[model samples]
Target: MHYRLEHADLSLILALVRGRSLARAAGLLKVDVSTVFRSVRRLEAALGRQLFEKSRAGYLPTSLAQSLAEQAERAEQALEAACVSLEQGGEVISGTVRLTCTASVLHVLLLPALARFMPAYPALTLELSTSNDFANLNRRDADIALRLTDSPPEHLVGRCLGTVSYRVCASPAYLSTAALGDLERLAWIAPDDFLPDHPSVSWRRQRFPGVVPNYRCNSMLSVAELARAGLGIAVLPDFMSGEQQGLQSLADVPPSYDTALWLLTRPDCRALRSVVTLFDELARAIRLGHAGGIPA
Candidate 1:
């Protein structure tokens, strides 16, 4: 505790909490595991406490680790604040922001927001990836992730931008042309990432009993299209739900439903220059329903 916690020390604590192997954590840092191990050993020696207890599963935290995590998180945040001061002479916030998310959210909500941000931070570069998997932030697959889940993995900092309502929707022409709406007659569009296990899907099933989706997809963008082309009714987020030109929200079915979109990053990463500035901008974009982020 005599020496201040460094960025590497903070990263080590978070990696261990995420339960990745020592080798995996080392690979993430592009260093050998022994070096990381030595760093931990050195830190422990400096603190005079056992930080981790080895188990078959992985290293589990001791009380000292828990304490260190809290202190380290604070230290990292303070360090990042110092970096913000350094940005004064740079004229622009310049750094690469790696973002991972679903395509629909990316296209519909995120892009619009970035449009505004990029102008202000001319030197900031945003590299976006769309995937269902929660991209590994600890390993730097992406610097930030926007996800439609309530809680994020431990050691990551999560902020709730807001929620997007879910509604069963279809094209108006399709609804008028087809003799559907009997609740038992229409086929549903199932997207892989936002699947049956998701609460939105559960809500749909509850609203319309005994109906199953015949068309399945892996992305919300696909499902939205399928519904727009009159394939079938699909349960979708409000941002995607309202934007489709001909779509009609099933007024009677379910109105009181919502899914939250969370902005997440490793706590230590949140303190990094690129991560904090981007997060602040991204958080603003999400709240404003900019950046193709679906409306809450």
Candidate 2:
């Protein structure tokens, strides 16, 4: 056939393949779900090949589509490597790159990555805003945001780092004495009334309404510390606990609610080389499992 696939076509295919869902692909491509759907239909018609099979899980790519995606990924990697090469060639990368995320994210995930990142890019200054509230990217409140939500903002373009699963955890010292099957009977370290809408708090309310927490803290970091100190069992993201922190999971908290972690930025802001550079660096660190299996 004489048909030719454009870069856009390859990118669309690759995004769909990697993202595994129209919604996720749309998020990564910074387009509407309808746009991704239409592009898939158009591509299939032109190429005369089935690219994906839709299932309850997500889009499953065919062998042909997978092969094409592999090629697209190589192209993407080459471009990124070239960018890094240029940066290393003494290309001055200056200006502030502001980022916002929750305090827990800073302590458990972003800090280790940033510790290594800051020293390398001396010219690049970073303004780290730690807040539970989502910063308004539309108003340019921040250059980038690492947010945990099922629905990321449509105006921003970015990648879903990964899904974060919650676990009911306590220090081995606490778990040794606590009853495992009767979770409600156990002493609980919970989010404060200030965070009534938090997933863990809501989960507790729904599942064990009569269970009063022994410790309540607005800050997840504090809650974690309280749990680590063997105060009570706390529902925490798996990244926060586990063998590394001397915590053991007593039960698995359902991830039926908000879980997806996204790294988002304004479309126009991506045009800035420094912003893109930081974005790439953070993304790289997360995917490589710098902190935990969050990006895996």
Question: In model 1, which regions exceed 4 Å deviation?
Answer: 1-90, 192-194, 243-245, 252-257, 288-296
Local accuracy of candidate 2 as per-residue lDDT tens digits, 152-250: 767678877777778889999987877787888889998897777787887888888999998899888889999999888999987888999779987
* Model 2 segments more than 4 A misplaced: 1-89, 136-138, 288-296
User: For each predicted model, how many residue pairs clash, with residues at least 3 apart or on different chains?
Assistant: 11, 0
TM-score of every model versus the real structure: 0.62, 0.65
Candidate 1 per-residue lDDT, tens place, 1-296, comes to 48776778877876665544678668766788898788878888987878888889777788878777767655655555456647665434555678898888898889888888777665556788987667557677888888887556666676777767777788876787776647458767867645556655677667666766788887788888999998878877888776444678874334455567888876667557777888877887677242232222
Question: Between which residue pairs do clashes occur in model 2?
Answer: none
Alpha carbon lDDT of each predicted model: 0.72, 0.83
* TM-score result, candidate 1: 0.62
Model 1 per-residue lDDT at 292: 34
